[model samples]
Target: MIQDMGLELIRIMGPFDANLLGRLLLTLVLSGLVGLERSGHERASGFRPHILVGIGACLVTMAGAYGFAELSSERDALRVASYVVSGIGFMGAGAILRHGTTVRGLTTAATLWGCAGIGITVAVGLGWLAIAGTLLFLFTLTVLEWFERRLNFGGPISRLRIHLRDDSRSVGKALDALVRLGVPVKRATVLPGAGTSALLDVELARTLSAEQAPLLARQLLTLKKYVVQVETAITPLDEPTTMDESDEVQKDDTIVPLNLKDATLLRDLNDPDEAVPGSQTERSR
Candidate 1:
């Protein structure tokens, strides 16, 4: 039985020749085009990686076709093709990223899958199909990106955290500043601060381009009379580092409001607990 199986395997991979090299080259060029486009967009995995995926997939497909076409054995070419899909899936996973709540790298993963299909088509001598497939993939990525932006399918969103002065006039001026910009704020939250610094959350009214928001932030911060800090917050939608996660200072974070006298005392003693509410009187050791 083992001898017969060996014979079947040998018969399946018949006649490897020079013509196969031409097919492989075609696959490489086509795959490279796809990879090049991705690279232009500044993705993590770009041209070379995409080309390799396409080439590898093509080789696998060639193996499958030859095994079934020549050997007339029990092996299923379709089954082999399915394996290529699963294999490329793993490669695609490498491109994906999951942070706090947002997922990126979807486009990169999709391109990998496309390159695999092109490879398989080329391996089978279906050059036109492979070329067409690649063109379609490129159009979807490039053209669709622009179309989506024009339609505002996924508009820009920004999170702004502002520290305003404690006076009512300052708060009014801050609101007026936002009103002038015509920014449609989605949500706003108030952060309680000490005597002078009051925290405020100001969500954008509408999505602004990445550049527009920062320039606007610098303008807002310029109002020195009542404005202390105007920071553009990085939302949890993007993966945040450990240090990025800070307890939104509720009323509990401070022992008491920081004052000039408290600053002087803390500066004098290494440990200033003697002056704290619950501490005992300091004694000479």
Candidate 2:
């Protein structure tokens, strides 16, 4: 009787005997592989979430294929599979984000959607196709990225935000510095800020190289009187080290005289009625 019971247990644990469990495990391995790639990139939806999505999609597909075997003539096996496809969109939508003119997380969303497809494929017993699809997915993420970088293909553009004194002279000086450094300005906007400062938003052109980006940032810092802060998406080569506190105070005192001179010149230009000093001397002669 014990020998017969062992034989029965073997039958219960056979591949065909437990097909649902096999499908679920296949889904986990395939999705987990894709998730590992995403996790390496530090995405929002990493390993665990991708695994769950894969397993859930696999379960749904398996249930539709087997659970309704009795009603196979009356019901369509693909009904539940169709629902999984549509329902995965809601999850994909959560991964996308939009900031100003830039949109992020698109690739992550597509990856999640692909994971669901892989799960469905595995559930239908097309294991070989699912594996091939996953290998292609990884190639797109890894190899394609390397190719893009090598060919100088522009992906996401970088943004630079500058806070500076609220003066037209300051704006002109800042623009001049960026232009001189060969940094192409795609779009520039000036927004009013608190106190006497203004915010400048600049989108850079694609031609800017990573090496040149930090140099441009350092050049902007030299305009200490006009530029209060410079923020960029690119990481700086070194910490933003500024001059000594005492030196900064001394520079501030020295800058006041030049500012007064500029203010006088601006006032003279605006008020045409004010006689120019050289012109008055010439009239007396």
| TM-scores for all predictions | 0.53, 0.57
Badly placed stretches (over 4 Å) of model 2 are 1-16, 154-205, 209-285
RMSD vs true structure, all candidates: 14.1, 13.2
C-alpha lDDT values of all predictions = 0.68, 0.70
The number of residue pairs in model 2 that clash at the backbone is: 0
Model 1 weakest lDDT span, ten residues long:
240-249
Off by over 4 Å in 1: 1-16, 68-75, 154-285
Point to the candidate with the largest lDDT.
2
lDDT of 1 by residue, 191-283 (tens): 787676787776654454444444455555555666676666444265311111221222223222212112222222222334645445533
Considering only N, C-alpha and C atoms within 3 Å, which residue pairs clash in candidate 1? 12-71, 156-207, 184-205, 185-205
The 10 consecutive residues of candidate 2 with the worst lDDT sum are 249-258
